[model samples]
Structure formats: C-alpha cells, structure tokens
Target: MKFLQIAAIAAALSALTFGCQKKAEKKASYPPTPATLVKAEGKSVRKYIDTLGTISSLHSVNIVPQVSGQIVKINFEQGQFVKEGDVLAEIDPRPYAAAVMQAEGNLRQAEAQLKIDALDVERNRKLAKDNYVDKQTFDSLLAKVEVDKGVVETCKAALETARINLDWCKIKSPISGKVGLYNINSGNVVAAGTSVITTIEQLDRLYVDFVVPSQRLYDVKRFMEANGGKAAVDVSYIEDDLGHRKTVAEVDIILNKIRYESGTAVLRGRLDNKDGLFWPNQPVKVRVNLEEIKGAVLIPNMCIQIGPKEPFVYIAAPYKDGVYVISQRDVGEGQLFDGGMRAVSGVKDGEMVVKSVSSLRLQAGPFVYAATPEGLIMGADSKPILDPAKMREFMSNATAIADELRAKFAKEAAEAAAKKQAPVEALKAAEKAAAGE
Candidate 1:
C-alpha cells in the first residue's frame, strides 16, 4: 500500500512539471519586429503583350538591266537613295541611238514605197475604168498596194520598239528606295533581263513581322474589331527607350494560319520610318496593348511571401492599445505590373503590406514596427505617402537633434571628471599637512 502511494505521488510531480513548462512557453512573447512597409493602391493598369519582331521593307527590288549593253556611266553611288524613274546607271546609248536611226530610215523607205503603190493603184483603177487595163491586172496592182501598206505598219511597230529599247539604255529606279552595292560597274557588259545591277529597298515605310501565340489571336482580333478593325501596335529597335509609344499598321491578314510547330502565328505591322531608323531584317521589339484594367490593386513584388500552399503577405495593423501587429494574409497573385509591382486580389486598396522585414520569421498577430515613406506612419489603413522632399526634411531634422544631444553629453562628462579630481587633490593636501604637524 505504501509503494502504491509513492507511485501516485511521483506521477503527480511529473504532470506538474509538464504543466509548468507549458505555461512558461505560452507566456513568452516576441518583441516588435521592424519591417519596411508599402501601401496597396488602386490605379489604371494597361496590359501589354511583348514579342520580338523583325523589320522588313514592303518593297524590295533586284534591279536588272532591261537591255544588254556596256555600262557607260554609273549614275548613282552605292547606298544612295533614289526616287522612282531616277536614272541609276547609263548604258552605252550610242549603239541604241544608231539602231533607232536605222529603224527610222527603214520606216521612211516603207512609207515612201506605200505612197508610190497607192498612186499606181489610183492610176490602175482609172485605166481599168477606161478599158485600157485588164481586170486581173488592176486587181494585182491593188494587191501590191495593200501589201506595201502592211509593210509600212510593220516598220512603224519596229521603230517604236527601237525607241523603247533606246530609252531602256538609261537604267532607272523601279521604286523609290535606298540602293545597295552596285553589282555591275561602269564598263561591265550586262545581259538583258538577266544581270542584276543592284538592289533597291523601300525604307521610308517599313514592315515589321512578329509572331504571337495562338492563344492571343482571339483577344487580338476582338480588340482590333472594337477599335476600328485596326490593332494598334508599336515597333522600336532593341536599343530604343520605351517611353515614347509609336503606332503600327494593322496587318490585312492576322495570322492567316497557325504554325503547328510553335503554336504561334505571324503578325505583320507597318511602321513609317521618316527618320530612317528602321531597316530591313533588323531585330526589334514590338508591344501590343491588349486591354486596360481599372482600379487594379498593386503591391511590390518583394512583399509576397510564397509558401507551400499559396503566396501571402504580412498585413500590418494596430491594436486598440496603439501597438502595431502583423498577420499573414493569403493573396491570389495576378499578372505583373509596371515598376516591379504585381496585381493582387486578396488585399484591398489602401491596405498596408510588409515589404521587407528585419527577420524572415513571421507569425500571426506578431507585434511589428512599420517603416514607410511618410515619416514612419503606422497601423492598418495607413499608406506610405511618398514625397521625396518631405523625407529629406525629416532626415535633416533628425540629424540635427542627434548632433545636439551628442555635444551636450560630452560637456556633462567633462564637468563630472573635473569635480571628481578636485576632491581627490584636496584630500591629498590635507594628509600632507597632518604629516608635517
């Protein structure tokens, strides 16, 4: 019986110890953690889809000689811009000029023969009417006149062809564009319709070709239809600043067919490059604004804390006792916005979120100290009113106060030391007087 009683006492002691430990742990409290905080605000957000594009010329021509001849004069420099019908090069026109003269002479001879035949036909008709010529002979004379008239018409066509060939000796630009390197220089014999003189590319108005995912085709079409059947896009070189947004022409056919390999479709945009900033086959960036979201709740990207389940942020609020506390609030993250911010759904507008904390350790209802742009504003509905000038003013005033305090403390320490030393010296002098006595 005594052994059983001792066992019961031991069990009681063990339970008591466990209870005390639990109480001590429960009573422990963490100090207020210092955290950098940002405010969630509502604003107009523009959604944009970005992709790489290539600049291409709408018109690219490989200039070829229309007539075979030796180049007598190279009228244009390599890489010079020329307008349509501008003379680019001059082939040896002397031969073509001589050919034109010869054709003209042939035409004149045919016309003179036709005139003589007509006069003979008139005389033959009179002879036949007067019975001075047989009917068969008159018919033969009329046939000769008709044949001569046919010869004259053929000669006129030949003369026109000769003139056209002569004009082609002066090679002209087929389109207004910048010319590439000369393939055939002066004194080089070019084959008609075969040898390439040079290449011309129209750069004033350029085409930019890009690809968009097949998923976005519907949105692109819908947006375009709502906005005058034209999807406004912008194209800029990779090195250009994104501040200025330029407009791009809508493609007549938007992604005519989907690419099976990449699940993308080709989109072509036209840009007017009056400044000659764009070039053919040049790599560029394209931006297409799809839609706008009004009253978007945005927060800094760094504020979101990812967990095993979902992403969340620390909501810093204050208790009725004037002590600020932080609670973890789960958030549904949306697409990223400008300025490294993200659109979030859980947090309301004007809500304070912990952007950065001194320690990564976080818990529910933990005490927190909030730092903000607006002179250390604290609590739940508080937002950091960002004013650079105000922040500078606050820093200057704080620095001045610190310097004054430091100087006052130094002076007080010096006075205290002097007082202590005088008492010690006076005591030593009194002891010396007693020794003398």
Candidate 2:
C-alpha cells in the first residue's frame, strides 16, 4: 500500500510539470504587433543647449525732462512707435521762454554799458596824455572801465545758461522704439532729471538673455572663438493667434561672472526684431548650438522608449511576408535637434526602428507588422500606400484584428485567474467535508 501511494504521488508531480510546460508554450506564442517603422539615417546633427530666456531691447531708455516745469502737452499716443529726436512731450515753456527774453535784455544792457565805458576810457586817456585831467581822475576812470568789463562778462555767462534752460523744456525720445504709457500726464509738474516722462525700447534689434550651466561655458567659448567670436543660436516663442515661430540669432557676449547660487553663466544673443515679432521682457525658448556630430545615426524622437533600466529603441529586421522581427536595443546618450529628431548611438544607418509602440505589448524576439499611423498595413518594403481602396480595406482589417486580439487576451487572462483559484476552492471544500465528518 505504501509503495503504491508513493508511485501515485510521483506520477501526479510529473503530470503537473507537463501541464506547466504546455502553458508556457501557449504563452510564448504571440500575434504580430502592428507598429509604424522608420529607417534610421546618417547625418550631421547639431548639438544644442536648451534653456528659457528673456527678450530685451538692444537699447532701452527712460525719458525724463531736463528742466522742471508742468507738462503742457503730450505728443505721442500710448504704445506708439516713435523715432529718435521725436518730441514726446512738452513742458510749460512760458517760464523758460520768459527767462530767455530776460537774459537777452540783460546781455544787451551789458553790451551798451561796456561801449559807454570804453568811450569814457578813451576820452580819459586823451585827457591824461594832454595833462588836461588830473592823473588821479584819469586812473580812476580806467579802473571804472575795467570794473564794467568784468560785469559784462558775468552777464554774458548768465544769459547763455538761461538760453540752455529754455531749450530743455521739450522732451524728446532718445532712441527709436515703442513708447510706453505716460507716467505723468499733462498739467502735472515734474522735476528735471528725476521724474520719468515715459519709456522707449528699440525694437529693430533685440538681445536674448539666457543662462546655462557653468560647465558649458567652455563649449560656448570654444564655438565663439572658432567662429569669429559669435556662436549660433535659435530663439523660439509662440503667439496667441499665430502659433509658433523661430528665428536665428548669434551670441554677442557672455557675462563676466557666473551666479554662485545657480551655478550658471549668462549669455546674451543678438536677434533682429525688425518685424517686431519679439518684445522686451518677453520670455522665450533659447537653443545655443555648440557643435555638430558627424555621421551620427538620426531617428525621430518618438521612437525612443524609456525602459526600466535605460532608454531604448525597437529595431525591426525584415522577416517573411511583410513581417519584422523586433529586437530592443539600448541607446547611449542622445542629443535632440530641430524637427523632432534626435541623434543617438547604438543604432546603425539604414536600420528600421519602430516609431511608435505605445499601444502594443512588445518584447524582444517577437514578430511585428509595419503599419501606417492610420492603421493601414504597409508594404514589405515600407513603401507609401498610394491606393485608396487598398488603404481602406487594410484599415478595416487592422481594426478588426486589434479588437479580436484584445478580446482573446482578456479571455485567456480570465481563464488563468480561474485556474489559479480552483485548487484553493477545492482545498477549502475538502477541509469543510472533513470537519463535518
């Protein structure tokens, strides 16, 4: 009886092992996943350092009055584009004008008195030479003429100063730019050199200011030193109604010192804003081109997948009948460039990579079919689908296949769960029966 029981247990174990093997075999067989594939190309990829930056006018200034007086007239409309030397506002010139008139009258009076003194000195010298006048009297007359000459010079200087003050009443724009709103309106008194009248920013040319890690300072310096003291850069920003726009610029200068708190150095690029696309103090995206990688494998950024250990891409090798064998390859450091592409290592030129696999449960060593974004099966060579009827038919079939696979996978999962619970249910039933006995 004991030998028979031992043999029965051994036979049961063997059968269980066989059943597990069968399950494993069934799980290993998977349907071909549909995905879009793109061929990797070899090209020179420009490496860039991306960061947020701010737009600033090349020349910005705050307009102020040169003489203190009440504002009489505002010449410019708010937010109007103005040119250099354009009168922006006018101060009460009546006071300054009156002072100019007073200075002119004073200068005229001084000149007339100096002429009279010169005549008196000439007459007194003649009298002193002829001995008709006493020496004391002639000398006294000469001293009086000299005193009058000194007074005339003092009046001349005062008149010039008064004339200058009169010209300062008119406030003009110092640079060609758009004018900001008025700070002090007409009829308000503003102090000279202290009160701000308005602000202007030159929009024909702009400066893009951005910061990068201090470690990258050397790279930027190298690029500039090699390329005539200017490094290539691109500035991009979005408009509310116009979507996105980008413009090329060049780095003009790097700040002399780095910020200790952020460990970054500031770089300023010169950007042409003749179209007025960029504004002062506007935030923008900046890309500083450092260097180019030659003969690098380039692929669309969407093809990269973040795995548990590292970023990877699925390489697809042509198999039989429009199917491909998928193999996951771990890529090295990647640099993003324009047009949604990235330069990456570990992929070779002319190799096909899966562009998108988010909807598919994929693994290494599985077969996949190349499909378009619209789910139309592509040709074995991944050529463009030119036939409308064929695309429609394939799209319908692809949708049906996807739905069927999903249902089948769900059913299998349900069955596996049920199988796992069957033994527990059986054991519970047996325990209840034994207790009842």
Candidate 3:
C-alpha cells in the first residue's frame, strides 16, 4: 500500500508541473501593444518673437484745400481711387476767373502808363539838352518813369498770384490713393487749411507696426546685422469668413527711442498691399524672425510629453517582426512654429517618435505594433490595415482584447502578492507549531 501511494503522489506532482508550464507559455503569447509614431525630420527652424501689430498705410493724408471757395462739383466718387493731380472736386471758378481778369487789366494799364512815362522822359531829355524844357521838369519826368516801372512789376506779381488762386479752385489729389467721403460737399464753402475736404490713404504698401521688449532689441540687431541689415517678419491676420492669411514682410525701421512706460521698442515692417487684403488700423499678429537654427530636429507638438522634471519624447526602435521597442528621451524644446511643429534637441533625424500608445502603463522595452492615428493596426508590411472589412473585424474584437489584457494584468499582480506573502505565512505556521509543542 505504501508503494502504490508513492506512485500516485509522483504522478500528481508531475501533472501539476506540466500544467504550470503550459500556463506560463499561454501568458507569454499576448499580442504587442499598438502605438502611433511620427518620423522626426531634419529642417531649418526659425526662432521668432511674437507680438501684436497694427496695419497702417505708408501714407495717410487728410485732404484740406489750399484756397477757400464754394465747392461747385465733387469730381470724385466716395472711396474712389485717385491718382496724383486727379481732380477730386471743383470749386466755383467764376469769382477766381474774374479776379484773374481784373489783375490782367490792371497789369495792362500799368504797362500803358509806363510806356507813356518813358516816351515823355525821352522827349524831355532831348528838350533839356537843347534848353527847350526846364531841368527840374526833365528830372521829374525821369522819376515818374522809374515809379511807373515799379507799378508794372507789382501788377505782374498780382497777376501771378491771381492765376495761382484760380488753379486752386479745382481741388486735386496730391497723392495716388483711395479717397474717403467728402466732408464739405458742393455749394458749401470750406476754409483753406482749416476744413478737411476728404481723406486719402495709400494702399499700395502697408506698414505693420509692432513693439518688442527692449531687452530683445539686441537680438533683433544681431539678426539684422547677419541678414543684410534687415530682419524678416511675418504678418498674419484672420478674417471673419475666410481663414488665416500670412505674408512675408521686410523689417524697415526701428524707432530710435524706446517707450519708457512700456519698456518696449517700436518696430515697423513693410508689406505689399497690392491685393487690398489689408487695411489701415487693422490689428494683426506679427512674428519677427530673430534667428534660424539649421539642421534642427523637427517633430510634431503632440509627440512631446511633460515629465515631472522636464519634457520628454518616446523614441521607437524597430525590433523584430514589425514590432518596435519604445524608449523615453529627455529633450530640450526650442521654438514653436505654425502647423503644429516644434524644434527639439536630443532626437536624431529620421528616427521614429511614438506619438501615442494604446496602454496607459506602457514602459521601456515593451513590444509595440505600428498603428495609424485612427487606431487601425498596421500589417506586416508596416502599412495600416485599410480594408473596411478587416478594420471592422479588428475593432469588433478590440473590446475583448482589452478585457483580456486587464484580466491578465490583474492576475499577475495577485500572483506577485501571493508570492510575497508565502514566506511570511510559512514562518507564522512554523512559530505556531513550535508554540503548540
């Protein structure tokens, strides 16, 4: 009976060992986690200083008349584009024309009188030589001739002034620009240099005025010195219906003095406004490119993860059978650009970065399959499974897979706890047995 019992005990122990080995093999067969990755690119990244800006015309003029008169006719439509010397409005020219005529008549009279006085002086000079005329009378005639010549010059000046005033009656544009509404319309008299006739803003080129902290002035100067004495700028604005628009502008001027109250220096950039997309006094965003970092590692903004100490990114290395091993890397972040890209260091060019992971507790050395941002698992060819039927099948079983993984993790945790308690439990049992003895 003892031999039979020993054989049965040996068989039971062997079966239990086999069952434990099989369970271990099954647990190891779980599929790799899915991860989405983006390839880091090598490119030039520009460092910029961002600030708010205002769009202003390079030339804005408040049109005021040089001569006062009644406005007879408005020659330009409201908001019309006018060239320099284009007739904008016509004042009543009747009075001005009459003044010119009167001045001409007076000038003609002065010339006639001067001619008579000169003839008299010539005839008297001959008489004085022959003693046919008195010496005092001849001298007086010559004096009259000189006085008449002075009167002619004065009348000529008056005529020129009258002509100029007449020309001013027709108000004309002094610059090529768009005209604003007429302030003083037809039949209304406007004071010279006092009443604003209209406004004109030159829209061919615009100025983007912005301010930067005074501390950044040195940086701007450095960039300018390196880049042909001018730094590049980007001006952007958003419209109500249309989306954002941006254009490259040239930095033209920096104010000589900084604002004491704001501790900022004013800067201006020139933008081409031929498209008429920008307007005076319009607010916009300005980005001043202070410097450029060549051959910088560029990655998507989403790839960066904030850690307790610093920012980090997950790098993926190709392992076996289309699986990747993930590793964390601390990185120094640089400038952020449009289109959700950022400049970073400590990442090699052309390396794959894990953008996201399926499991929350994913750590280093975990095998992961490449997946699309849409969660579709990639095939052995490293392409996403785009077939609708296959995608549906994978999605349908995703919940089951997740549940299985959760159960497996829970079971492993419980086994580890049990292992830790096993030694303590045995020690307690031995102590209890000793006490009983």
Candidate 4:
C-alpha cells in the first residue's frame, strides 16, 4: 500500500510540471503590446548639425612698450575694463624729461647762433654794398647764415622728438577694451624692443572665427543671396545657461576657400557687444543660416531614429482592412532645419511618421499589435506609443554597449603593445650578445 501511494504522488507531480510548462509557452508566444498606436506621418524633418565655436572681440589690441624705461607705475589694474583713450601703464619720465631739457638748451644755443650769423650777414652785405668790403667776404657771411639756419632747424627737430618721447612715457591706451593680466609689475624694467606688458581687447565689436564643414556652405550662400549677399549673414550671441540670444550689428563675413589642412573653410561673424560681454578668443556657438530647403516636408525631431548606417522612420499605411499598419522606411536626410533633421527624400507632405523610435525598436517584436487612431484594436497594438522614460533607458543601454565595445578595443590594443614590447626586448638581448656580453 505504501508503494502504491508513492507511484500516485510521482504521477501527480509530473502532471503539474507539464501544465506549468504549457502555460509559460503560451505566455512567451504572445507578449503584451502597447495600447495606443502612434503612426508615422510622412513629412520632412530637419537635421541640425551641431558643432563647437568660439567667441571673439571685434577690436582686440595688444599693449606693447615702445620706449624703454623702468615701469614706474601701473596705470590700470589687471582685468580692468577700459575704453579707447584710457591710460594702461606708465614709464619713468625722468630720463625722457632730461633729454627734452637738453634738446631745449641745444635749440636755444642754435637760435643764439642764428641771430649772430644773421647780424654778421647783414653787416657784411651792407659793407659790400657801400663798396668797403669784397664780394667774397659778403658771400662767406651769407653762407654762415644759411648754415646757422640749418642748425636751428635740426635742433628744433630734436626738441620735437624729445617731447614726443616724453609724452609716450604716459603709456596711454591704444584702444578701449578689457585689459589682460599684467605681465610687468611696478619698477619692472621695460625695454624698447620686445615684451608685451599687457593686452587690451575691445569688446564693443567682436569677430568669431569658426569652421564650416563645406557641406552646408552652399545652403548658406544661397540663403544669403536670396535676401542680400553681405546683408543676410546674421550674427547672434547666446549667453550661457539658456540665456536669450541677441543679434549684434553688421559683423559677418565668410571665408572664400576651405583650409587644406583641416578640410574646413573658416567663416567669421562680427557682433556689436556694447554690454562688454564677448572678449577676444572666448569661444561660443554660432549658427549661420545659409538657405531654406523650400517646401521640404518637415516633421518633429523625435519622430526619426538615428542608427549607425542612416536615419529612418516608421509610417502608417493602409492594409487590407481599411486600417493603418506600421511601415518602416529609410529617409534621405539634409541639413538641420530649426534644430530638427531635414528630410530631403523618402517622405511627402501630410504623411505621419512615428516619433520616439527608440521604444518602438524594442517594444515591437517581429510584428507589433497596432491600435488605429480610429480606436479600433486590429489584432494587437503593433504601433508604438512612446514611453519617454523607458525609451531613455533603452538609449542608455545602447550607449553603454558602445562604451563596452570601445573598452574591448582598447584592451586588445594594450595587449598587442605588450606583445610588441617583448620582441624589442629580445632584439636588445641579441644586440648585447653581438657586443660580447
């Protein structure tokens, strides 16, 4: 009777296991689908190509010491914002003052000599005219007067030069701008030749030197030509942290040719920075609108999915039962329009493309159950409704996978380097052997 009980128990356990397996298989065969189907409307989307740029000043100037002397005093503080006629630094004027005094004394002596020469010339001419003196004597006196006049002129020139040098010791500003760090301190000996004491970058007008990849330049020129070639290049400055972008006055220029070294053409834009915002060499983002992809189909940036090979979208098409079914197609993307991807090909106006393709890539299996906009559940909802949070997680996973692959490559590279080093070691040993070690 105990053996019979055991056999019955074993049979019951086997039946229960079989039932659980069947249920699991059924559940695996059909997964839960989304409730609402977001159909892809056929339309154009803009592809915004993002790049890094730097901000610059329109009138940046450097402060160099032209005349040599000890930097007696710092006329302005470091990082001080100054204007066109502001004084920046001062040089010791004592030496220049002495030179001016010397020049002035020389000029006075020259003037005295000129007066004596003039009196002699006049007296000699009168004597010759009265027939009491010879023409040779009068001519010699006239020559003396001419030489004295030349001496006076030379002394005057020297005096003017001395005064100019004396004035230069004041070390006023060449331009209105913000001063850079002080390279030379007070009592530092500055010379005539070379050494930048400081720099003054004029922030009122600024130029941005940026590179265009040459792909979008055509669009830019065309857009500008439609409005007016030179007039159309609009300059805008955006402050950090989502600050409002403002348009500065009349400061835009495009470089004619691409730089052969970088394969990118340099473009420049000018900004009127009255608020002293942009400084020289400060980097910022600059967007230059070239031209419009006129009448091109536009769609929400979220609608399209960016893959390794190309961008694609999911659209709704009419199937057998007057219901919209999801269809996937590749799109030809153009320049970015309004921070969105521009759809150049593969779509038409008024067609719906599904937005947020990340979730759809995972949620929909080989076939998704789709619920139509008409509120009819045909089969299961095959069209994907985006759960932004879940989609973000999937995207993060993809990025993590990419990072892992990169790490693997890096590891392999390190291992390969170790292997290569071993051969070099052997080569060194062989060389030591040849050297009779």
**Candidate 3 residues 96-117, lDDT tens each?**
8999999999999999999999
Candidate number with the higher TM-score (2 or 3): 3
Question: Which stretches in model 2 have alpha-carbon errors above 4 Å?
Answer: 1-36, 116-150, 239-243, 302-314, 319-330, 354-378, 383-437
Q: Which portions of model 3 show Cα errors greater than 4 Å?
A: 1-32, 45-52, 112-149, 212-216, 231-236, 240-248, 259-264, 285-292, 363-367, 385-437
**What TM-score fits each model?**
0.72, 0.69, 0.71, 0.65
Off by over 4 Å in 1: 1-27, 126-140, 240-253, 304-314, 317-333, 357-360, 364-367, 372-437
Model 1 Cα lDDT, one tens digit per residue, 1-437: 22223323433344345567855563222334456877798888977777888888999999898999999998999989999999998888888899899999999999999899889888788789999999999999889889998999998998999999999999999899999997988999999999999999999998888888899888888887887777777776676575353546555457679999999988887778888777899888788777888998999999998878989887876433224456678899987866889999999999878888754433211445565543363433455425777545534543343233333333454455579799999999999999995
**lDDT of predicted model 2:** 0.79
Query: What tens-digit string does per-residue lDDT give for candidate 4 at 337-422?
Result: 55454554677776655553235433222122344555334342354336677445534543444333333433554565579799
Comparing candidate 3 with candidate 4, which one achieves the higher lDDT?
3
| Candidate number with the higher lDDT (1 or 4) | 1
Worst 10 residues of 2 by lDDT: 1-10
Task: Give candidate 4 regions above 4 Å deviation.
Answer: 1-50, 222-227, 231-251, 300-314, 318-322, 326-331, 338-340, 354-437
lDDT of 1 at 391: 46
What is the Å distance of residue 303 in model 4 from its true position? 5.5
lDDT assessment of candidate 4: 0.62
Q: Which ten residues in a row have the lowest lDDT in candidate 3?
A: 1-10
Reference-based TM-score, model 2? 0.69
Clash list (residue pairs), candidate 3: none
Question: Which of 2 and 3 is ahead in lDDT?
Answer: 3
